[model samples]
Target: MASVTSAESGRLGTLPLGYYSCSEPGDAGGQAWIDLPDKHFTIGNGSTYHTDAGSGTYLLTGKRVIFTRGPMKGVRFERSGKVTLRWIDEDGKPGRVRCVRQASSV
Candidate 1:
């Protein structure tokens, strides 16, 4: 399950794996945009891209999340115990993120 906090944006979980990328007109979960050519970028947790397209998936342990910024955030609760995320990519493309677990915090 996903731990949720108030609108405070405090550190909530652990991001074991970080991902980033360099992409063209479209950006995905692990991609970025660069003026230069043939360059790669690393996607680390807590890293924000200038483009709304830039999003990070930090591994969450047993803590909850509090969204302190943004106009809209779509967080969901399901029977499978999962969460799907949508963030702007570095290239400005809408990216989809999914998180799954057996159980959430009590």
Candidate 2:
């Protein structure tokens, strides 16, 4: 079990540090750059090349990551791989935006 505040330090371990973009479920999902250990994250739209949109803090719970601050607060995502996550968009909706991790250089 892991505490919600420091989930990555416990059972979930470290999250892949870098950027993740959602291209499968259309443009609404956008992209995000996650910096672990620090728990800071940034979100941006496609046209902006993910330069900036909003910033926030996040926490991991089991296989899911919860955005805790900023405009994306309450957003939830579940890990699909070491570097992939599926964003759960809209409450009670049954689709997910596939966000793939990219090299930090991007």
Candidate 3:
């Protein structure tokens, strides 16, 4: 696999790099968090009972970003803002999320 070296590349237009939280309505238990950087990606939850860790390789095409490997393979993500992304699961469920450039220090 080719390592991501540049934050600004040819295909991926402009992607946010930071922490994102699930913001779908009625999703009170949606503790999922997704972190995307210049290179790889990480997905997890900080909930007390949910112990899960995930990582994957992803690439951007037009308005959609596809996870090519790992747990979220085939998931499609679209930019909602510089610090936000909305995505649909492989099962076709829709969701929206907001992110901050910085992670929580707590």
Question: Which lDDT values do the candidates have, in the order given?
Answer: 0.31, 0.54, 0.47
| Alpha-carbon RMSD, candidate 1 | 12.2
Tens-digit lDDT track for model 3 on 1-106?
Answer: 9884442233654344434444333335754544443322333332111113556566665556666666656666665556555666566554543333344222
Per-residue lDDT tens digits for candidate 1, residues 6-67, read: 42244445322223233343267644432222222222336221123343332332333212
lDDT of 2: 0.54
Candidate 2 residue lDDT tens string, 1-106: 9453443344533456566655443344653433332222333332112225556666665677667676567767777778777767677232445666666543
Structure candidate 2, residue pairs in collision: none
Superposing every Cα of model 2 onto the true structure, what RMSD results? Answer: 9.7
Compare the candidates by TM-score and give the number of the best one.
Answer: 2
Compute each candidate's TM-score over C-alphas. Answer: 0.22, 0.57, 0.49
Sort by lDDT, top down from the best = 2, 3, 1
Tell how far residue 103 is off in model 1, in angstroms: 24
Please report how far candidate 2 places residue 27 from its true position, in Å.
14
